[model samples]
Target: MGDLTFEDVTVRYGSRRRGVTAVDRVRLTVPAGAVVGLVGESGSGKSTLARAAVGLTPVTGGRILLGGRPLPRPGRAGPRPLQMVFQDPYSSLDPRMTVGESIAEAVARDVARGATARRAEVTRLLELVGLADERAERYPAELSGGQRQRVALARALAGRPEVIIADEITSALDVSIQGTVLNLVRDLRRRMRLSMLFISHNLAVVRYVSDIVAVMYLGRIVEYGPVDQVLGDPRHPYTRELLAAAPDLRAVGSDLAHVGSDVGDGTPTGSAIAVGADRVRIALADVEPADPHHPPSGCRFHPRCPIGPMVHPDREICRLTEPDPEPHQHRAACHFAATVETAPVTPARRSR
Candidate 1:
């Protein structure tokens, strides 16, 4: 297995000149045998990046490499080296096919050419995901949400992939069911040494499973680094705000709490972060995100930034220049990133 690298990937939609750019010049990696978590808001383009990696979406620029080579085109295939498990299990699977048939269809020809072999493979895959062999005869509607998600994972594994992209796989499920699916993913990673790009809004879940974490805003990656360093010692204002907004962290007690404990064991003691954090209930919270087709000038985040312009008029560099992601232990795309660690956790000071 090799690293899955996205070098300056860009994805645009509709007319190139007038369309929206969903994913903008993203550079990320899912190292072999590691899980990289992608976290962001609703329109952050995490799903678009995942789709592009699997050829389900076209790239307008840059390259997606697997083991240092371009990913294979969709139809020109053997067993797919990369596979995606989509967010919605209900729509991802076909109602016409039984669970066995769905998993069997993705089975590599070499792995299961004959009918008996296919059945065995299906049974094995089912059991691999903690499902009973007999459940293969049931339709998708017959199973619960968690069970269906496991089936979706089982289908992705059927391709014998080197990497897996799980796009909000638990967002649609209840909390109880969500935990079971997360547990399965953690277990599978241990058993298979799977390389993954896990996308989600839940910071605690990401902390539990990811080795690396990449934070996105709008269509850009604003911060990224190892899980502990990135989450424990966030350098980006958006990352700090994101971490502070987490219910788990806020409830846990303080910011330093997550830094010491809450290292992905599922039982996070406290959630709200106190360091470099400023919860924007009335300020950044009310400001609408700018149009992706025509993002804000200079820094895309300046208008909502807690440390720029409205918050500190003297700090005008954020409005006059675009700061590239810094080269450091924890990278952040902010002109004042060097001072973020020292930035005080003030009350919401209305964003302009």
Candidate 2:
């Protein structure tokens, strides 16, 4: 396995006049033989960053490196050390070629070999992915969704890549099948000592596969650290919200009280009663989603932040300047992240 590093990477789409910045000066590293899980909601640039690692997307600024070496140009005449397993296996594989031929083709690209040798290599790759040798004869449409994805993995393995970018590979399969695929990937990573960037919206799935976790929001990493520290003691409000939203009954102390409210009559009403026995809520609903084109002045999340000046006094810094990613016990991008405990959540009601 090789080290994968994103050095201040920035990816923008369209022209300067009307463009969208997908990844903004993101700096992250995936060490050799380690699995890093990147989690975020839709449109948070997780997939964009993953594509950049494999040279599938153009970088508006910054560079991507493998083992401290710059990535080769796409059309360079050599085998690349990186491979990607995409979300839709059906679309990624060749419909015309059988599974065996596809894997053999990948082998041919990676190494000059005769037909018999290519077939032998394909058999070994299939066995590595837990597929029978004869299953290679099946077509993409003839096999089950799980089998197709397995074939995709087998093909990726044929390249002998140092790093594997797994982008929501099991997203299209059933839950049971997803588990089987995840198990297979975990086993293969350990046996091969492979480095992987596992990108998914499912926090649980990410937690299951990743040694390190990075939480992304609006094209920035809000929190990143070891999985246990980042997920168990989440420092970012966004991370807390994501974890709280997905409750795991089996996990100890995983429940969080819902602190949302409704908007009506120009007043926000909440579940918790406020002073004077009246129910008051922070106007989180009034906060509009940030436009990727314009963004906000200071913190991109301040508008939707439920706990700030409204909860604590003299917290105007949140509106005036953005907090750089700070490395304490965990890395977080919030000015009041340390003072978050003092911020109000549900105020008690006064007896009237």
Best by lDDT: 1
The worst-scoring run of ten residues by lDDT in candidate 2 lies at: 255-264
TM-score of every candidate? 0.90, 0.85
**Model 2 bad stretches (over 4 Å):** 108-112, 249-286, 309-313, 342-352
Q: What is the C-alpha RMSD of each candidate to the true structure, in Å?
A: 4.7, 9.4
Per-prediction tally of clashes: 10, 0
lDDT per residue (tens digit) for residues 76-130 in model 2? 8777788999999999999999999999888844464788788888889999988
Q: Which pairs of residues collide in candidate 1?
A: 208-264, 248-271, 249-271, 249-272, 250-271, 250-272, 252-270, 252-271, 255-273, 255-274
Native-referenced Cα lDDT, model 1 = 0.83
lDDT of 1 by residue, 132-248 (tens): 999999999999999999999999999899999999998998866776787789889989999999999888778777889999988889998988777776777888878766654
Cα lDDT for residue 252, candidate 1: 28
